[model samples]
Target: MADAAPRLLELAEHALSTPFPLRLRAWDGSEAGPSGAPVLVVRGRRALRRLMWRPGELGLARAWVAGDLDVDGDLYEALDLLSGLFWERGADGSGAGRAETLRDLAAMLRDPATYRLLRSGLALAGPGLPPPPPHEEARRRTGIAHTRRRDKAAVAHHYDVGNDFYELVLGPSMVYSCALWPEPGTTLEQAQYAKLDLVCRKLGLREGRRLLDVGCGWGSMVLHAAEHYGVQATGITLSVEQAAYARKRIADAGLADRIEIRVQDYRDVRDGPYDAISSIGMAEHVGSDRYLEYARTLHALLKPGGRLLNHQIGRRPVRDEQAYRIDEFIDRYVFPDGELAPIGATVSRLEEAGFEVRDVEALREHYARTLRAWVGNLEDRWDDAAAVTTEGRARVWRLYMAASAVSFERNRIGVNQVLAVRAEAGGGSGMPATRSAWLS
Candidate 1:
């Protein structure tokens, strides 16, 4: 016991010395009591102790799930602190190497029991839990399908599920994208409302102006825009179920006069020169090859000088092609046929297509918080979720939630919501003075 105390102190000191100052705690007095920070205590030295011998990369994660670790403050903040530790490393120093060491330590801390339970549950859950096919295989399969079918299937497989299923997890507004944490102390709900309002403000929506919501799911933003901003909203979605549910929602909200939901592909959309456009959580489906086409379509649809907001997932800069792989598990279980392009790539496409990039905000940590909340909601309604999609789907979601949590935790994926404006050639115009002014 005496020897364990010094070793634990050394481990804690190592973690603290890193960019992420990790605090340790124990359930029993075996390791010289808690040092006033979060504590992670296991039953004994033989159990999951080896996993924590050094604050390995995933050590804290394994400890949290095994009931061996508890955080005194915010979980997201803890994760942010951990991520900062990894990011504080620069090219000229030894910090980068130490960060790598922490990551290696994290891998060693995996709890076998937790891994086993999660794996077993997913195996029972259904076809959705299949391992992702190789990236080439996925690309080939997608290419074989007609472009329209490919797009529709991609959207349907993700959003055609029962609206009740989403309602169970998402807030009453059913806004599934990352909530914009505008100020430092904003609550989730407030941030979400602010996000919706921010979108509306960016679009410069006004009464009688027609706003197009491409790939709109369940019409949450459509209703919000119409009701709050007095804009006439038309939402297009490839998912019939989503369109149908959104129509009902619109009618129920007594917004049939101002809002409409249509089941149509974005390519087939020719409604008109919309005053504004917003595609939230939809651009991920616009494959890298089709990004240019998407930009052209938006350009053609928007009225001269109109603005468009694109909120989608993006990949960080990868040193080589090897760094990018079609995450098979995500493809097979979560978003079939989805692809995430780098933000730079998307911006290039927009610029080539004649749109000016106005603002870009990375909501990486906010998305982590959003996913965490979703996981908590799913776990809280595990029985109901199991009933809706069967145990296999439930298991698939469980795997997805955990994997996604780790992905964001490790900085593998990011969310960038960009605002771009259509600038007509030969038209004299100045950019907005302050993008932040819209937040006010």
Candidate 2:
């Protein structure tokens, strides 16, 4: 066992040499990498066993979820540091060869503690380790993906976690999507309000107009539109929890008559001919196969000359082999079945569905900023957030949001608000001749 500490240190030294400083601490009190740096604490032997069996991001994620792995110091910084090493390894095709692998095995066998840990890890069953507990794997949605029933389950899995938890993370403003930060240093609430107002202006919402908010999370847009724009707003979502919370919010504002929240799919919304539609932060779930259907559905639901704002996350095709190697950890753990299409695909689908694309704005930086705000909120109110859900679930959000922020910042993904209009029979979109009016 005395030799185990040094052998483990050697393994980390060779396996995880990063450009930036990172400290890896094993459960047996052995340390590797730069001393006094950010600590990646391996809580127990189980973490190593999990990593050995599962491998890659999923293994690391499971270990973190199960509380067998953790980091000391800034979580975001630690993730970034670790990602640098992972990306570097991915860039170099050559991994540990036969000789190096044999050397590691020889060292492990000579050390009682390391040998025991290796034996335990190898004893685990074929392919991968047992799946994480039900709670940890909750994000792995069941049934056919993107169907109404399956989509409902997926939505419920993510949004129905708890309104209180979301409230803490989203703050009082309760806007979940990317916010328009008109100026630097604007608070989340202010930015969210600005974003809502911006959308209203873009859609040209006004009194006597009917607005439909598809996949409206907690009625933020619905309430904002009804109160500020004086539009008769209808918000629909598959999550029963969101509907309940949004309905209460509408009632509390005494705007129940002006705003309606329904737990229904956008496909089922037959009460059509809406004067305007705002599908904020919802289009991502409208799978690639159903994108045209989504565009056509919105087109049919809107009156001629009515505008539709389809806000969604988009991905620029990854040309970097290293980046492309990282699979969709988000789908497995956070937004199951949520698919991000390219902005071009999105615009083309709308055009094919008889929509005249008016404005296409990419708020990639705004989304990164918004996610950072949410991450800050969650970290600040971590105790409350953790209480609302399990620590594992909270960890899931923290990691997912932080990584997503980086992804957005790096142009790996983008959030675009595509404003398209249903042309009248005469082909008039009824749009302003200039973008100046919307800017105001």
Candidate 3:
């Protein structure tokens, strides 16, 4: 089985033409590729078994998450390299040759368990084995999709991991959404601060104004508004860990009197007519079927002529549904039931909810930059992050963030800050005629 590893690569040489200079190391003293190349080590028989059983990106993800396979160098680059093999076309404008690909695949399936599974075309979830803990349980959702109970469960599943882990990834700012890079040299903290303040400015937040932040992560925006803008701020989140950490931070910052953090759902918030609302990075979780409900709820929460700055990730319009494969991996491993609607769809829904769309700004490049910065932070603090969360969870984040960055950069996905206003009875939005007031 070990000797066949090298032979398998040799068979799929066409796919490796422009691949990263990486070495493949098998567990049983067998190696492939250049001597000093970055190592992708198959640590045990399980890696091959997984590949043989599932035989595609899913199998690769499972093996990688289970630590059956590991990467020794630039994790982002290695992921990109592997992804290129499946997506990139050959000189003949087609993918890898069928016969060679099949031969290579067969070489990895020589083991008895893998062979049996391959022949049966069935996946076995065993008792003692427990299906490689992380990969097996990653996709388990708690309740029905988009229900109030299910949404809370999904939010908790993703965000309740640990506040310490989030702090490590998000830096001192503690903002989980996209950060606006003011310039090429700006740091992540700076970008996040800018993004938070930008939302404040867009909403025209002022002293004594009541601000509600839906899906606020760690109360970054809430604290910023309370401290800097002098607004009475309220932040809601499903993650109990986030609420606890945010409350502690608010107290420590001497803003407890002005800011509040609650482990509450958006639908449950009965507090009415806030001067402004900020829903950063939360809209994606409101499934398409419930998107209008989400929009309407926020619209109802705002006072007449009140502003809403909703920042969310959105998908680009695409003809090929297969291009959404990355979303499947994301749903399984990272965000359990998250959905990214297209920008147009999002705007239409908001409009349907009676919001006067004041501004629509696509921050695709900015989100890509933000994600890359996060990926870099996670990589730099790899050991520290692993201590906070499992190595498998960290790997899941690292891979998902890198892939999302690429998607944003390529316009496959996007992030937008949609500025809307609850119009008065006289059809007045009470917004500045031009965006110049908010731009500066």
Candidate 4:
């Protein structure tokens, strides 16, 4: 069966040459697969070879967990390619596809024997698998924290990684929020700038106007608004590290006079009566129960006829909890105390807070692209990143990339940019109709 390796390589070549065009390297003495492809196969030890041959999603996941399989190209692209093979045709009694794969995986998860076997394999193969950290540890540690302690822990655990690590992956803008991809072929940096501009345009920002950025990270959006749009911007963040970095960045940009970063809670943002407000990637911290309070706080902060743009992650309305293990995983490892409310819920709360919802754009696919870029960046700088953060952090980011790719691809999670207007008292006709009126 020496020819079996050749046959497998041939099959993989065929699959890769198809629409997927996967780049992978087989370390075995298999025929040096396709030529000029990004995928590479390096000769490795016997244990690595055995780990690579294992079938199904669990096997791939385990291989990743054990660091047995490493994709030199884009991890997201690799995931996209592997997603096609997640369910093999004729593997189950039914035909191969998503349905069959999920069915098989579900069955495996449910069966006691299968569960024990998988668990045992994981115990033996996986390295440094520790019990999940207590959820509220961060909140208990940081007194006067608004969000749940577990939630804060999750956010801190994820974001508190060194700033330089995020800088390498996120580029010069350091905008970790979703990008607004205006058109195909848009570079990640261009899309990010466009997203910031889009927010400024939507909010009717103008020179001499005061703008408040709630939960601002590293002052990217606010600084952009101040520099390019001619607005004075103030940013508030819960992260001390982020605030310090943002202050330095503002000073470096010569905008320390025009832009300020405050290490304060969103609830405590008082230097307002601002002309416009933006909360980019911040609403997730407000929790599902506190969304109303969040909306009300924005309403109180804005001046009459001012606009507010809330960019956030949203969950679709669904009763199916079984398919959402990723959410639980995110809560435990990534975000901890975070909760995603459905888009409808967010709109309802906004309306209840007496704001006029002007527009809601679901940038779900754009977020997929954004995350794909981030995962690609992570993979490209994995070694440097590993040096900057803890091993647990690396594992968490790996899982986050894989699960987030699935979530975005399947539309289980969404990114929404909601634009609302704070109606003038006594309610005359709302803000102007022309874009130039705002921009000029």
Candidate 5:
């Protein structure tokens, strides 16, 4: 039984042409590898079989979601170690997505050890058919990308993962985007409030103004703006669950008179000429091909001189931008059809859409901290969260959030707020002359 771990590690190292970085603990309670390294607990051969058949991000994701694979120590340390091999692959070629992508199968076909490797890997995974994907796994969508119907499905898959589950994870604030941490001692709720207020300030929300929040999650932004800034706020989301949850929250907050929550897609938004617009943590779902359209839509919807604040997650720009592929695990298990663009391209697109890009603030570290807090909340209430959402779904969020936190920490990715405005035809931008007003 103890040989199980060593054999699996040796096979993995040989096949991948690299050292197996994490310690391995096999099903029979066998353990091997560096004594102090983060331990990857393989509960059974099914996890190995999943990895063997899928050979990449999806395989790893399937195993994790199904509970066949798990981490025994600090998740960040384990994922950070694998980040170079299977985590953040960019133009530097750090080997992301799949082990097969890194492995030279053609070379292996010519290698005499290939047959022995295959046989050993097969025997190790044991006798079994490939495991079916977990029920929580999203069904892959078909047809043209970013169609309103497809977008709605995508949103439903991600955001409709039950409001209670989100509440357990996101805390009472329900502000899913990056928080604006003013100080180290700031609580998550406080940071979230600061973030909403910051967006309101940047957009210059005021009494009697009409504000639109695109992809508003659970009504936090609209409620805050309407209550604090006295604006007539409208929040639109494709998720029926989100809309319902947000509407109820707004009613409870006694802001229903000022805020309107609608299950509406951004493209279908007919009401326009808003004084200000906030698209927080939403544009990632707007697919790269539709991003310019998204920008144009926001520009067209806003009044002249009206500001638009877009807070979105961003990836590092690779030398060959066209080569970018959405991570398979994220696409399948998490944000299906979601895409992240470099912030520079995001600014360029907004400017191309007739808006003067006024400011770009990177809240990368803020998001990292926010995710850690959310992960803590989830970990603290793991049973409650898992009860509302399946264990598989909970596992997905855990890995996603923890890995994202590390990604932000290592600068592999970031979240940024791009503030822009539709300049008046006479070129009056209506923005304050100095950054002090906004920064303050």
Candidate 6:
């Protein structure tokens, strides 16, 4: 009997005091907002109650995961529009930071219209207790943040979501890290190959040399290094599934003799004096508190003059580092307990661990393109992926990757390859006068 969509939009806009720029379609088929805008579809009353309970990012994430909320139009365009209002760093005046948002909420509570908004929301939500979080949400949270046990759980939550699922999303290469595109039209597989080759080159991997790949996801790095560079490689990862998958891939490629895949923690690694060590896309999981230990562990495991290529994700530094917080959705559902540091801080920590920081190359744009490609893969095979994993799990990956693409495109975060070497006692870093030797 009620046309709920228009009233819902009116209440939301009045409550936030900012215009709702997109379309909203209610469960009863009533629609609101501009004619051509992306549509936010509310499939059930549960979506509103979930948002009412948690208010910000996590609430929306839960709704989206539970399938109570969905977008009927372009996902990226909808997310880009919403990011300015709910997320973003508030630097460009399109978004508000926590302090500003809190002030705005306080101001809204004082407004008489907010009472009407609250009543409308309650009537729509029509409630029982908020629906339980989706089964796909990350659960285990017993041990210390980055301790071995907890770290394993965290890695498993994100990576052990079925290798078939990742294969569909990551393509044939199966490299989860950012790819290096030589040019715009490069295929994802080609870019990924280029990225692996670049790291091997930077570390100067050669025949008969030992290379250790810390946090080697699915064994892409080790396989590439051994096959192309003629190196004996060992790859370590916390995910059992990843290790198994990598081993199978190595066997299929006939490179098992040249590469070893182990499901072992980096701290437990004892085989030392490796000529090259690569920690690609893994350092973000090393909590800031344990970063020094991480760096030192790799340093101690490397031969003097051995190169450590830390291909990691970096975040933009803020004025007050102490107050910094990881994204709630990312912490709760995606990479649990993961943290990012500015490239400057990462380089400093490596240097403190007796590494001479050699090169810090930011590949921010490349990551945007890589993420976009991954998103395309997932979108193209959405049905098959959801069948492999739960729909909620697939949704989480889609949302995170799409948002991350926007984040990288806008420079909110970045990916960098920090090439550092354990300088020999004489202070020589293996004597490469110019990058020309490795650029090829």
Query: lDDT for each of the candidates?
Result: 0.68, 0.80, 0.78, 0.69, 0.88, 0.88
- Candidates sorted by lDDT, best first: 5, 6, 2, 3, 4, 1
Backbone clash tally for model 4? 10
- Which regions in candidate 5 have their CA more than 4 angstroms from the true location? 92-106, 438-440
Each model's total of backbone clashes: 10, 0, 0, 10, 0, 0
The candidate, 1 or 5, that scores higher on TM-score is: 5
Q: For candidate 5, what's the RMSD?
A: 1.7
Give one digit per residue, the lDDT tens place, for model 2 in 277-314. Answer: 99998998888779899899999999999999888898
lDDT of each residue in 331-369, candidate 5, tens digit only = 998898999998989999999999999998999999999
TM-score of each: 0.68, 0.86, 0.84, 0.71, 0.96, 0.95
* Model 2: residues with Cα > 4 Å off, grouped in runs: 1-21, 35-37, 85-131, 139-143, 319-328
Residue-by-residue lDDT tens digits, candidate 1, 53-95:
4244333333333334444544444555554555444222233
Which window of 10 residues has the lowest lDDT sum in candidate 5? 93-102
**lDDT by residue for model 6 over 216-295, one digit each (tens)?**
99989999998888999999999999999999999999998899988899999998989999999999999999999999
lDDT, candidate 1, residue 386?
Answer: 70
Q: What TM-score, to 2 decimals, does candidate 6 have?
A: 0.95
Worst 10-residue stretch by lDDT in candidate 6? 90-99
Query: Which scores higher on lDDT, 4 or 5?
Result: 5
> TM-score-based ranking, best first?
5, 6, 2, 3, 4, 1
Give residue 334's error in model 5 in angstroms: 0.6
Candidate 1 TM-score, C-alpha based: 0.68
**Residue ranges of candidate 3 with Cα displaced over 4 Å:** 10-23, 29-39, 85-136, 320-326
Task: Record all residue pairs in model 5 with backbone atoms less than 3 Å apart, i.e. clashing.
Answer: none
